[model samples]
Target: MSQWQQPGDRRTRGRVLRWNLAGWILFGLLPQAVAVLDASPARRYWLLGLLVLIALCHTVVVNRPDNPLLRHGTYLHLLALVLGSTAYLMDGGAAFYVVSLPQFWLFTRAPRDAITLSGAAAALTVFGGTLHQGWSPQFLTGNVISTVVACVAGAGLGLWVHHFVVRSNERQEQLTAALALTQKELAAAYQQQGAAQERERLAREIHDTLAQGFASIVVLAEAARAAAVNDPVRCAEQLTSIEQTARENLAEARVLVGSAPESGVAAGSLAITLRRTLDRFAQDTGLTVTAELPDVDLDQRTRVALLRCTQESLANVRKHSGASTVGVVLTELAGGVELEITDDGCGFVVEDSRGYGLDGMRRRLAELDGELSVISSLGDGTRVLASLPTHSQDRA
Candidate 1:
């Protein structure tokens, strides 16, 4: 009935009940039944009826050990049976008292109750024998002394077993509590870790798409304002570029917010995608740009990573690199594919740079088991190389 009781404990309790029943049959019922074989018919029948009544009481006690009335009443009834049987059968009934000793412990819940009832049974057993035999030395030595000794030993053994079971149950409850606490903490930790990773992903997505588009919008707005009067044609082109950039930023926003199912990158040749991006960069910055991008098969993940790396690299070149020439190259290697973007701009030390754009690019590539490398120095140019393995390539 206790929560600590497992299936195994139920099985063990069943086994103990079977063994106890076996003990009763072998020592209590069989010996007494055999001893009364030569007795008169009425005495034999009455004794057998009493035995059946005792067995029924035992069954009721065992079935409902938690019921206070049944448990207590059965112990008292069994004690009366022991006394009556001892007096009625005299020497023949002595075995019944001895065999019934264990029932006191079996039927009672507490050690005090078991010890008290067993002591009473022992006393009743000795008194019944003394009443019939007149305190004979043979009866005292054979029955009285043995009953007293058994009562003391059974009480001690029952107390020890009761102590052991209580301690074991307490320990099991403690372990169950600890395991529940651990599982709760583990689930909370997993939720926190998932939330943190999701935050990082959103940050990367904004930086690669929305943030870059906004930056381009600012540049185009400034150019359109400057060429407004003198260069109306150039200003109109800048305005068109601005409108296109705003629409693209809107699309990227929709994707980030879950309204759009697809990414900002269109499904097409990777070379054409890079070329269109380059043409936009040239139009905005008026910088000389040359690129050699061949058609290469790549999975969506690899394609997105490389495109982000190119965009981030070009953004750096425009903002930081005050150079006149930039070149982009996409090549297929024996084991993988690679993208290289170079600028003749005044490059900064790669090791000293700790920009989030660069870190985002590296993370994006790393997700595909790819790598990003930036080569630069104070006076020299910067070269950004992004490489991805061919295993995830889409042949179709």
Candidate 2:
């Protein structure tokens, strides 16, 4: 098969064969058909046999258009030339048979070979035609001119068809390559998106389950130690509560890690949840932590954002800040909510990129169209502020 013969080339190959065959019928067969009818019975039968031979040979070659003629297939072109020359000698109408030699050569040979072979075929055709008619000044001159014109016309047509085919093949290859590249890119993007979603899921799970559970354990252990000398019953209860909280945390962690994360926080009880979170933080840290959050209704996402921001801020204070006092304030506005956490710690310079806790807090608030800001300086303090928009309520 030819290199240009792709899986979808069957239709294209068929069209080329049909067009070339049509040209041969009009230019070669029709003329011979007319002349054969005027010849004697023996001559007519001979001419008809030659016509049938040409058609059969051409049919066999055209049937396998994708099979390159150059691959030990010069026989097809030689047969065409021979049959064409014989028909031309019998009658002038079969000139197209000789004319089609260049078209066949174009497919079978390189440019130089095709040109050389086409010239030879033209010479043979002229000689055959002249000899069949007997040498005469008018006939020889006419044969020479007509044969030259046919050869030149056929070569030009064949070259044009070859160029067009080459260009079409190149374009098809380019389109196929581009489509493959696009598919690869889409697969990569899908993989990246899946990875990002997985990471986010893990972060939220750890923050809600393991980290909160650890904080409670620390507080319970501290309380048990303090009550050890004074109240045996209280210490025992504290240990029991610690054990229960630990089991619950383990179960929650298993659920989160083993399956898809829960859909989202519930809308109601946000204020209560926040207050409980703050109470736990105060008990855990033993620092003078103050809060002023109202009982006004807020969406689940907004509540989660504010709660996370508080958790992250207090965590940073415990880990990094040497502060004794912290203040958390939540204010409900006409169209939004504001949260602020202030600390009188040995503050450091705010770097270009905020610390991990602050960055996470910022990202969480940003998802709800909220803004996060931090103000801090050496030896002074740090204040983290967040604000989120809220739709106005309809008063009954």
Q: What lDDT does each candidate get?
A: 0.79, 0.70
lDDT of candidate 2 over 25-124, digit per residue (tens)? 7777777767779778887777777777766667666786544443555644565466446635474422654646635553563445566667766766
Residue 268's lDDT within candidate 2 is: 69
lDDT of 2 at 204: 63
TM-score of candidate 1 relative to the true fold: 0.81
Determine which window of 10 residues in candidate 1 has minimal summed lDDT.
1-10
Which parts of model 1 are misplaced by more than 4 Å? 1-8, 50-107, 127-134, 266-272, 332-335, 390-396
Which is the leading candidate under lDDT? 1
| Candidate 1: tens digits of C-alpha lDDT, residues 1-396 | 222222236567656656876798788877777776788888688767776777766665556646553544555556555555645564624467667776666556567877787787777777766776767888878888887787788888877877777788888779999999999999999999999988999999899889899999999899899999899999999999999889988988998889987675567678888998999999988999999999987777777788899899998988899989999999999989999999998999888898999999998889888899999998799999998997654532
Candidate 1 deviation (Cα RMSD): 3.9
Task: Give the per-residue Cα lDDT of candidate 1 at 124.
Answer: 74
* Poorly placed runs, candidate 2 (over 4 Å): 1-18, 21-86, 102-131, 135-139, 144-216, 219-223, 231-241, 244-252, 263-269, 283-306, 317-339, 342-354, 366-370, 376-382, 388-396
* Clash list (residue pairs), candidate 2: none
lDDT of 2: 0.70
